[model samples]
Target: MNRRTFIESMGILGAASLLPISCLHMQPTTNYKLGYQLFSIRDEMTKDPIGTLKLLKKLGYQDFEIYGFDAEKGMYYGYTAADFKMILDDLGLTVSSGHYGFSGFLNAPEDILIRFVDQCIQGADTLNSAYITWPWIAPEQRTLDNFKIMSKKLNIIGEQVKAAGLGFAYHNHGYEFDDHNGQNGYDIILSETDAALVKLQMDMYWVMHSSKYTPKELIQKQPGRYVMWHIKDMDTKTRDYTELGNGSIDYTTLLPDPIASGLEYYYIEQGGNFAQNSIQSATDSATYFKEHLQKYL
Candidate 1:
């Protein structure tokens, strides 16, 4: 059977969950294991980082993707990188990847660029994550020339991070989908960057919500460049963030070409509407993916 057929055959096994390990026809790999970017849990984290990590573990997360590690603070939420790493390790969770904002470096004085880059490098290295990302672009810097400038600088930033032994990526939001000279900024980033040196972390929700392109089309055309993906969902009525599979995206079509798309990790993100709080939002996403995504797998 083909990969898709094999997955479809399982169809949400009930006996398998209770049976011995050997009887299982499907064993999820790290590739398919559900993970959440800590930013989705940012509010809970601000309240208590250690408590948040414990809660996420209880909610069935084995992998994590983090953001906003202020080097100055020496901790993300009053927990040092070493301290935070220990907490995750004890819970059998791994920090798969994270967002590393480079706008500060891109906008800082020349003398301060290296300092900012070093700070990012320090946090990424400390966490042992595979990819560090520049999360978004400032609205005012939307001109074609600025896009080119951003690309050149990102390429430079990729080189610097790669030299430090970590991969570099750009994470998209809806703004990058807007047209400039009838071409999008995302097009420029894709065309200008060296694929070997840089990777793209496709934010599927933003691409779908803002642009006409679908995630599958982007992966098909840009194969091997998208190393990570933000698996966010959007409600059609409000165009706002929602739980996975509870929104309009067709994830079945999206995951089948994982290898072709060069995807290593997929991180769940819900920008806001943490009605119950961040950990609860994460648990809802993880639970949804576990129960519903298998059909699509």
Candidate 2:
């Protein structure tokens, strides 16, 4: 996916749990796995994937959701799937999912789309990733008509991914919540895609920023279908991305029941608007989450 458009498109789009603020804020705890999307530290990973993973692991992040798989080369960060997996293994880190570039095929022919999806599936298998996620569509393709077509393709892709013993999910941004007359793109996605085949990867920041429904209410609409989550906080004044606990979202009350949401994994992500720098933002978010938000998940 194009990281610049990932932020700039009309720009859009936002999960969770309940734990009292007083009860939280404890010393760093263990046993639970916290995930961070590598896209948050894309620059660092590009320069030094090994060093970046090592630092993120030291910050108490155990699970990861990766982005920008080079489908043509069948590589990630210039490393083959097996090699990358080995890197994570040596670092005591796990990558359960990834944001692949499937959105580019939104208008491509079936055969082309299938070819790309199959490539993504192979990469996922090599890494033992449980899910291959479709991150975002280009802004021009966000029309209601395209969403309908997108939903159909989602089912087809989901069927193929599921056949390979993996899960398929669509990650939402603010654009999906844009009102198209009475029906929004998200509505079409939820209503048209088969729940058994296509799962939802709810980005809590976009849901809150763009959608009218609260994260809890959105899950209530289709509870078990949501298999993944992108957890990020929104800047209070500019509505941009900020480090966790330094933004407007109130996870203490906003996080939905894990059981209700079919919550499998959640990743802390900030595409842009970092407080200091990307790596520091990742470390800061990790610290904030361990102290304040880990218990809720």
Best by lDDT: 2
- What alpha-carbon RMSD in Å does predicted model 1 have with respect to the real structure? 7.0
lDDT of 2 at 176: 90
Q: Looking at candidate 2, what is the lDDT of residue 239?
A: 99
- Where model 1 places Cα greater than 4 Å from the true spot, the runs are 1-31, 294-297
State every prediction's TM-score relative to the real structure. 0.85, 0.89
- Could you say which candidate leads in TM-score? 2
lDDT of 2 by residue, 188-224 (tens): 9999999999999999999999999988898889988
